[model samples]
Target chain A: MTTDGSWRHTAPERGDAVTISVDGEPVRACTGETVAAAMLAAGAAFERDRSGAPRAPLCNMGTCFECAATVDGRLLTRTCLIPAREGMVIKTPGRL
Target chain B: MFDLAIIGAGPAGMSAALTAADHGLTVVVIDEQQRAGGQIFRQPPETFAGSVLHPTAGYGWATELIRRFEADPRLTTEFGWSAIGVLHDDAEPDGLCVAINHPEHGTRMIGARRLLIATGAYDLPVAFPGWTLPGVMTAGGVQTLVKAQKIAPVGDVVLAGAHPLLLLVADLLIRDGVPVREVAFAQSIPTPVDMLRALGAVPGHLRMLTETGAILARLVRKRVRVSSRTIVTAARGTEHVSRIELARVDRRWKVTGAPREVAASHLVLGYGFSASTELARQIGCELVFDSPRGGWVVAHDERLQTSVPGVFVAGEPTGVAGADQSRAEGTLAGLGIAASLGRAVPAAAFAEAERGIHASTRFSAVVQSIFEPVRGALGDLATRETTVCRCELVTRGELDDFLESSPFVSNVNAVKLSCRTGMGPCQGRYCENSVGAILASAREQTIGLGGRFSAHLPIKPVPVGDLRDLDAVTEQPASDGSDTGRSAS
Candidate 1:
């Protein structure tokens, strides 16, 4: 996965960066960043459908539920609603 | 039981809480989001190190409202609480119960003597072929991704739809350094004559004019293609959006030319917003169909109180007049609620709020005339195979077939029963407006005034575990026989 930060704009300031696992691959995230934001910034798709088609986050508000992922073994957690904590495990549906 | 309960933490709810609390009424404000600023001025989490600058010019007012709301001791703010249902009790007569669900708290019921619903609006779901594809999303969704999450969908992005919000979203994306390939507006930019006429009603709309000018300048500088009187008829891609088909449309939004395909990775569709009246409808608020006001807004008197006594609606729940109107209505409702509770509210306060509301309403009327979705726009774009209801995967063809076969299906609820149009996780929030339009058109009836199905409880999807917890709470016999009917209605 591309984690070069091409999609991320430099903010005026950033919180402390921490590492989180996406599909068991370590991805860097800033404190207070949503899991969905971290994944999108790191060039990771939010989830995959039964057809193995990658789905990106839409309606970053929790309404769409399109950004749901398995977090720390729990299923269908809304990544957009969850703050990215250090060492948190996020697995996309394709990985599962 | 709280003296007052406000749903949604947007400007309206926050302002109401502040005004009511200032008048000595204890208030509890509940919101579904994790924080107080609601969508317009949504703030990043406290843990977020980056500053969240307001995208528009009214940051001062929003910041002041949020600051006062946070500092008020008499007001309790509950974040991450989704109101699922509103219940009326004969025993309490004037009091009502709000069923709320939190991830940590499971399910709980809060009783309040007065209920104010300021639940805002959501984007009007416009169905066309391939709208169900992964890469297509509402423009508000895109704005949320950028504003709240500080993230943008990578790759080529194009915004297609009607409404001035499309311009605002383009400005936001451009500011965030997102590459916008094109923006296709289904309605042409207001004619010079129209703009001149509208200015007479809203001379204070200088901020909007400046903002629009800045956005247009940036779009021109960046070489982003802008097409007017055009609409996205279809999205073409295998897994996600790869290209979108656009066609020119006339004033009524009827296609007048051949469709053209444009390469895009993400397609943002916004045809303006629809009021979230589900909770109001569920609690028996009378509704009126006003398309320019975002369709089927909960009916309210001058005091913002609905037909159901003790229940008030402000903000977009009453109409889509933007934040200023929301704040004005919220202040008025707060004063009204305070007076109803026998609190002393100065007469001048009501006059001031009414003046503000009148000015804002006048400005909003100009906006609605210019940006409201053109009549027959959605139906014009909808194809037989186009998906109307994403949650239930109902297609336009299926809806048409059902309407033809079941002649008795005159209302939205009957259509839901016949084809499961709204039986998905969204609880018909996304598709109800479109389906209502389709139903009205099929019956050759003018699409306004009446014909909405009563919204049911559990307006939001809740976990079975939460329901069980609620069951446990209700199963305990009430101390009095009067509480027997308090179980889920």
Candidate 2:
């Protein structure tokens, strides 16, 4: 996704970057980007509900838990609240 | 224990912290976000170097206050923490105790002589067909993503609903190069006379007037279709938003035509906002229901103190007036706290703060009158097939069936029990009000009866592992008698 270049932000110069794994695939994002933003940027889907239907973030704020995913073996981790970190493993409903 | 402890580091909490510190009061504030500015002055990640080109809604004053609040040594802010439980019993006698938890840090009990719950508001969610799709979001939520993260959807975007945030966010999206197709409003276009009247009532805030005019002028020049009496009938898509449906409404907001479909990858809805009053209600501070003025807000006295003495409330928790009102109330609350602490208050500063409150009130009234949602607007939006409770996956049809079979189902809490509507991780923040509206239509009970559920301990979804260490915390038993108004939604 980052290779597509300027798909999201037109500004060519991004700040320092971090690498994290989303749905078992390595994704590069801005250093301080949230897991949800990184996932959305990488065109990845988040957790599935009890019905197994994919849920996207309705409220990017932490209050809405729609974007909850498993990060580093911690289940129910809100993607919007936690910042992206190096080598963090994120598990989502849809495979990328 | 500090002299003052505040929840939410938004405009109100940050302002209160600054005023308290200036008056020689020790202050500490906690916010769920990682920064001091709440939604209005949402600051990007400190590490992100990108800059936003435009400022909206008190950007200047809020920016200055947030900077001072962060740099002031006397004021301390604990970010990424939420108050889980509140205890104000005989144990501390000094003040109330707030139990907080973090995803990384386990749990800690903070005690303060005086407490302020300035927890802000969230986008009011109204369910409709295809609303659960991935591309649909609250307008403010998208604003945060665009304003803070500098990310925008690459495909077609549509902004719909009855809120000023829609206009502002639509303008922001266009500036960010997001292809926004249309700006739809459920309310009729505010006539020139209406705008003039509202503006005339609050003539001093010329900056706000000019800024709004400039945004509107730019939007008009861009040829972005801004239509009134339009409502989002449905979003048509499977997993992500592929298209959206728009319909025309009459003065009473009744659907008068078939929905017109348009291809869209993003849908931003801003129907209204509900105050995050979980902690306020949990502590038994009196709450009243005024739909436009932040539903189920804390009932405070002239000094901004909640029903519980030594516990003060300001900002959106008291009502959903924007940042301006919040700062005024925050300052007044700080002054009240300093006075209680036996500090000499500056008479001139106190008068100016009061004047600010009155001016904000005037502006708030105008904004409310313009952006208020008509009852008929939402009455016909969600269908029986729509998903009302996003957390529990309860559809309107399923809820209606439960209500039909179950005897004496009344109030939002009753609906929650009937089908586990509000039992999930969200704890009814998304579905409570929508379900309450359904109940009101069904004649079950009033829309809001002390929120979707009673204010319970551990208001947030604390990781199960963290609760194991809760055995050592003290418990305070407080009565709900403090709440004077509790019936209406």
Candidate 3:
């Protein structure tokens, strides 16, 4: 999996690094980074179709809702609109 | 209760709030975004280490406006609050209520003596085969990811669209070290004569021209392929987009050349913008059709007050004329609101604001003329198999079939009901405009009739549990001094 430092052009200078789990897999993220951003940075699909097809984040704005995923048991939460926190559990589409 | 309640914290709302507050008027600016800057000047998170300011020149003005807006004591800024519905009573004086929903606070109501709806606009909906693919998105959407979130999508990206914003997004992607393979514009590059005419139309706006020139120069230096009069006919892929097909089109957007395929991991498409007129329409504001102004816009007077008195509209809600125009209109509306409330505003100040508005509107007209999508362009790209409404899985064929079979179904709302085209989580924000266009063309009727869809309460999606709790939230009594005993019921 791609780390935040792999595809990033500039070094992130935010607060302490945090770990957020996606489908029980730990991913590294910074404090201010959004859940969608963290997943994209880590090269993980933020969504999946009913047939288990991987879906990337489109329209990072909350309007599209293409990046919606279950966060901490809440369904349809927009990952792009919410900031990532330590130990947050995210279930992508089709995972449930 | 606020003396003036402004929706949206973009250039227009912020300017209006700042101006109104400077006059000692109690004001509240409600915005859906977490920060004060709306889409154009959206700021990064406070903990974000990257520069909060936009890299583009002249945007520094936005930073100053945001700072002043937050520091002003008279202005109460409510971020992460979406204005769901508006209630107005003709029987009472200044009887206007704005229903706002906050993630943590549930639903709450705020009363205002005067209201300014500056909710702004979103990307125009353009449907095509494979548009629902994970990698396909609007140019503005991708720009937000890079500018506000500082996150770039991995792999090769292509910017395909009709507006000047495509160039801007491409420039940002290149600056952020994203692999932008090409920048494709649906309209042909302006001829020297056209450029000269545009410049002549907006005589003093040399900075606008210089900025465009600089972006083009950088793209040239980076060897980014720039094509014009080419449109993405289809985005081809399985779960995610892997490639796109481009076809040349004429001024009327009719296909004129053979289609060619290009490898791409991400496809960004923008066909201008559509005004977010739901709030204004909810309050029964008069709307008029003008393509140059980005479809239907709230009809307002020189003072920026709508036909409904004490109700004003600024920013993209009035028209998609960019931030400068929004700010100018906002200032005029603020002054008008203050004057209505018996506050002393100098006539000279009003005149100065009017002059600025006139200049910016003129410049906007010129830009709109050049960038407005060609009529029928979207319809031409959308095939029967193309997904028109992603939320409902409604395809172009289904809509066409519905229109063909149901002779009584003539408007957009009926289409929405018939096939659930817009009854999804997005609430028709993404597909209504495109569906309106297609239905209009198929029925041989003007697009305006199909474009008029009434906005219901809870403009954004709210859970059923939260909506049920709305009744429990105590409603604040009307404090505008002329209450007709409305209790937010």
True contacts kept of each: 0.43, 0.49, 0.40
DockQ: which candidate is best?
Answer: 2
Candidate 2: lDDT of B240? 77
Model 2 lDDT per residue over B407-475, tens place: 577767877877887788888888777777777767644555424566777887777887775654542
**Candidate 2 local lDDT, A1-96, one digit each (tens):** 432111275443446788999888898887667888778777777787778776788898888888988788777778898788888998875311
Residue B368 miss distance in model 2 (angstroms): 0.7
Candidate 1 docking DockQ: 0.38
Q: What share of the true interface contacts does candidate 3 keep?
A: 0.40
Whichever of 1 and 3 has more DockQ, that candidate is: 3
Q: What share of the true interface contacts does candidate 2 keep?
A: 0.49
Using alpha carbons, what is the TM-score of model 2?
0.92
Q: Which stretches of candidate 1 lie over 4 Å from their true place?
A: A1-28, A46-56, A69-77, A86-96, B89-91, B471-489
B1-489: candidate 1 lDDT, tens digit per residue: 677889999989998988997787778788887778778777866665646547476435788788777776566666877888888754577777788876545687777889999998888888788876767888887787677766666678889988778888988888877789899988877899878868777556667777778889889899999899899999988767888899989888889999998888789988888888899988888999888999889998888889999999999988898988898888999999999899998999999999989988888888888888764568657788877876666888999998999887688888888788777656777677778878888887767622775677777766666666543332212232123233331
Q: Looking at model 3 chain B, which ten-residue stretch has the lowest summed lDDT?
A: B480-489
When 1 and 2 are scored with TM-score, the better candidate is 2
lDDT scores of the candidates, listed in order: 0.78, 0.78, 0.78
